[model samples]
Target: MAAGDPNHVLHVARGIEPTEALAVLGAKPGLIRTCELPDSKPDEWTSLPCAALGIQPGTAAALLAGRIGEWTFVYDDLGFTCDDSATMALSADGRTAATSVFTINADASLLYAVGGEQVEWVNVDDLNLEEDLPGMPAELRAAFEAAGNVPTEDLEPGEADGDIGMRAACALAGLALTLEDVRRIPLLVVPFG
Candidate 1:
């Protein structure tokens, strides 16, 4: 995914706050910067260029785009247990939102999602058996287990393009019929923190 576009975005229809969803993903608070605007007004607040925040142009556009009530972002060491950090955004009503992690490469990316019918997430490489592991099906568990120790540093150019990570997430999210399936679902590509 591009620097500015969130690695994943979840549009919660009901029963959860955006902050609650972000917290579920292991995001903590500290030195984080934010931009808040009226819910019905997008341009009321002056937006910073994506480059200024070290984000992709597309990401900047999405975060700063129309009618969002609030937009907060930060990338700092906030006492997180993992080596991960991300730029996050939440709509004023705590429904629509997105997250982007700039430091992780394709090989080490972990995909996760929450606030839907199922709450699940998985490591594109090594998924934690102990966690809730949302959307994962019983049949695909063995496949992911068999592909253990998958390192992007060892793969061919196109082979490391988050295919495995995407597959695991799709299964966990119940969005795929097979490992090869590719649907346009929003995924949070969090690295091990």
Candidate 2:
């Protein structure tokens, strides 16, 4: 998938490493294997042949992770890493932000946590309604509004409001990714049971 494609993006602050982030998300160290995918898109990594990778079919899980500036970004195809406990664990040292988009159902969510406490959680589609995002910081609220302002005509076929919201959240968390970046960067292909 491209940069803003439908997927879950998790950002952990304070320069956490990929392995460390995975640990915080509860991956067993012995089960985690790191590899490089020099030729595949981030989304394709999830469909990797488990047998060939020496992992059982039903037990395999995958995610792409990398550090950008002072934050670590984890790209989860299944969107499971955005749960409350995981977010709190990831933000224990600083902050964590997650964005999830499921285009099939038009479900999109953004979550933010700081110092192990959740601060904001909102549906991207409801961003325009102030009452929908209680306790959200002024800067983040502004970012969400700005991201929602893009004209529908300007977005690509599969892109939607959620993608824009994800980008805004990533930017605020000090991440800047593009299709090329996803392709060229040697992000750790973290596979685990």
Candidate 3:
């Protein structure tokens, strides 16, 4: 949106290189907020470079206007709980992963079983719209609704542990990125399968 508005805004970016991703997403050069993630133990859901995006009035409209397709990942801070942040990971090779509750299905069991898994990449626009939203599992829909439109200041511990988080991680790895690179980012790798 407008520069220096002090309201939360979405960063719509794509590309493998971080700079390119921001450029493709039409990012404005400003001090957008970001969270720092510490090192995690093995078998943990690490962080993304850009995790939660602050949302304000017109945020949704901004996102829609700037969309590069479903290939674009949307991140925002949900006010209800401390753990409602989400985003997507774009790798150096044009591969992408999503972790936003709006992007991935957050099923605990599905995540545990598919952790670290990878598959062929697909364009977000190629997805069958008829089979997409209506086909979302009940758990995913509930999580999406529970993480309503609000921002929070509460701090919660631990990495994002859930099916959605794992799905994002797997999607990141699917991009053929190194674990070291993956560990440094604050994005959520939304799974396509």
Identify the leading candidate in terms of lDDT. Answer: 2
Residues 19-123, model 1: lDDT tens digits: 443454454433122333222322312223233234433322222211112322222211132222221212223332222222334333442222222223344
2 against 3, candidate with superior lDDT: 2
Which of the two, 2 or 3, has more TM-score? 2
Q: Give the TM-score of candidate 2.
A: 0.70
* Candidate 1 CA-lDDT value: 0.30
- Candidate maximizing TM-score: 2
Each model's lDDT comes to: 0.30, 0.57, 0.29
Superposed Cα deviation of residue 72, candidate 1 (Å): 19
Candidate 2 deviant stretches above 4 angstroms? 2-9, 38-60, 99-104, 129-135, 142-148, 153-160, 183-186
lDDT of 3 at 29: 31
